[model samples]
Target: MTAPKANAMKKTTKPAGAVRPKLAQEGFFGRSGYFFARALANLRQNVFVSVVTVGTISLALLIAALFLLVYVNLEGLANGWSDKVQITAYFDKEPAPLAVAALKTTVKSIPGTKSVTFISKQEAESRLRARLKGQESLLEGVNADVLPASLEIRLDREHRDNFAVTHYVAALKKVQGIGEVQYGEEWVQRFNTFMNFFRLMGLLLGSFLTIAVLFIVSNTIKLTIYARKEELELLSLVGATRFFIKAPFLIEGVLQGALGALLSLLALAGCYFAFLHNAGSFLGVNPAGAGLSFLSPLHLAVILGGGVLLGFIGSLTSLRRFVNV
Candidate 1:
């Protein structure tokens, strides 16, 4: 009878490790369902407060998104300008066929050279005439040969700075058959300095705006939490874990943030299309000759993530500061 009883016990009982996974899965699903339901109930119970909080978050995120877009485009423009920094090396005489080939090869071999384009006197004169537009007739009697043939040298990005350009210009000036090397030295230096300053200002402004959004959203969430204080207290009284009580509000915050971010994205898309349709020419072309781009895939992800993080932090603040449970 004792041996039979031991065999029956072994048949009825299972190992703890095997049972734990199944139990944990059920617990997680059950907890998630409960939290979702509670969050929906909270929203339904305070429709006005919910709208107000979501609206506030939407506006804040919209403003933040706009600044990010502007900063990104301006930075692109700055880089485009940097890449366009070129030195025009004018020749004393029109280069011979063999000399031109050798000059091209020599310039291409330069350490920092990005590209070298040889412009003939005729091409230079034609460009000048195009620029002169209505005043092109002023060059009616002028000899095309008076305009010197030149080599346009674009430097690599790392060598585009003022110091690097100065050294590059000096080196090019020493090359045979080159009369002068001209790059907008003073202006390029000043522009680079300005770009650095602008980036710094943008960073500071973004930080301040982010903090403002957090404070506003936290206070707004606080109002919602205050309205449901009694319910929260009752849940605590019923032996609900702190995680259980806070889970719903946390979910609510994230949903609100995501919704706000979605709304902002829609608004931005509309504005982007409207702006491009109305003023495509205003934003200059990139090196590829295409018009300016909207936020990249990575940046769009960042904006959404930023919104969710802002909401999570606000909810966490309200729960810790006001709700004991």
Candidate 2:
């Protein structure tokens, strides 16, 4: 070869000895620039696929959040109902005033007793009369003595559940003068059962929903990543590190997860407001009075973090499996 031709060859060719120095001079950004740039370019090229994946993930998260919202509100309502739980003990006959006073003190000594009010036969008769105000004729022949004197037992705020109330009732029955105990046992049991069922449903539904979310969203992510399978394979062939190959995908996953979670939260907020606005018409009670609330701060954080994590995992793990990179 002539001198000019040899010089041209030397300029055109990169020596093995100079490659490391060249890469070192470029530093971190230089070494990863094309991989990062191309990754971004691929994302731009596949906007439709990216959007579909985000939409799928958002819908899944929205559903889970909605369930949580309902569960929280229902739990609040159940707690309110539990708070109203009362146990009433009826006496066979009207006790003497002193006897009633002694009995009230004895009942008050029970562990969970908050307050005990003695209703004399006359007071009980008066209550019945007040209840039947519009039908006074029904009480024409009724006598005050017919109504049994009773102790109206209101339990402590924390111990109003059926079990506590039953235990209190047993303690009351053990009192010498106290008679039969009637505390709407069936109602309390049913309410507790319903509340328990609601909690259980929340657990089961949440589990199933999470599994469903992972399954469906994973498949969507798979398709999105699979669309760039050939590109990823080419990058691998060119000796790109796995980290570099996966960076763009990880970024895409995090973005999708975050955006989807935000949108779902927005949707949930809209639902909450809509429910509150129309609640009075259907339920006849103001939700404001009942103290309905949204998720706590911790819950919100968990959701946001969960979204980002879900996206990251989906990108990192699924990308590898989908493209076999």
How would you encode candidate 2's per-residue C-alpha lDDT over 1-325 as one tens digit per residue?
A: 9999999999999876874543433434665666566656766888898778878888888888888776777777777777667778888777787687788888888898888888888888999999999999999999998888888888876676677777778788988866788888898889878877888988998899888988887777777888878878998889866777787777778878888888888887788787844664567656765546778888777777778888888888777784454
- Measured against the true structure, the TM-scores of the candidates, in listed sequence, are 0.74, 0.73
Regions of candidate 1 where Cα sits further than 4 Å from its true position: 1-30, 76-84, 92-96, 109-112, 121-148, 156-159, 170-179, 273-293, 323-325
| lDDT, candidate 1, 1-325, per-residue tens | 6999999999999877775445433343667987898888988887898888888888888888888887777777777778768889999999986789899888877778999999999999999999999997798998789999999989998887777888888788878899977888888889778877998999999999888877877787788778778878898899877787788889889888887787787787787778843443765444244425688889888878877877788888878865575
Candidate 2 segments exceeding 4 Å error = 3-45, 91-126, 134-149, 154-165, 283-285, 289-298, 322-325
> Which structure among the candidates has the greatest lDDT?
1
Say what the RMSD of model 2 is.
Answer: 5.0
lDDT of each: 0.81, 0.78
RMSD of each: 8.6, 5.0
Local lDDT at 113 for model 2: 88
Count of steric clashes across candidates, in order? 0, 0
Clashes of 2: 0
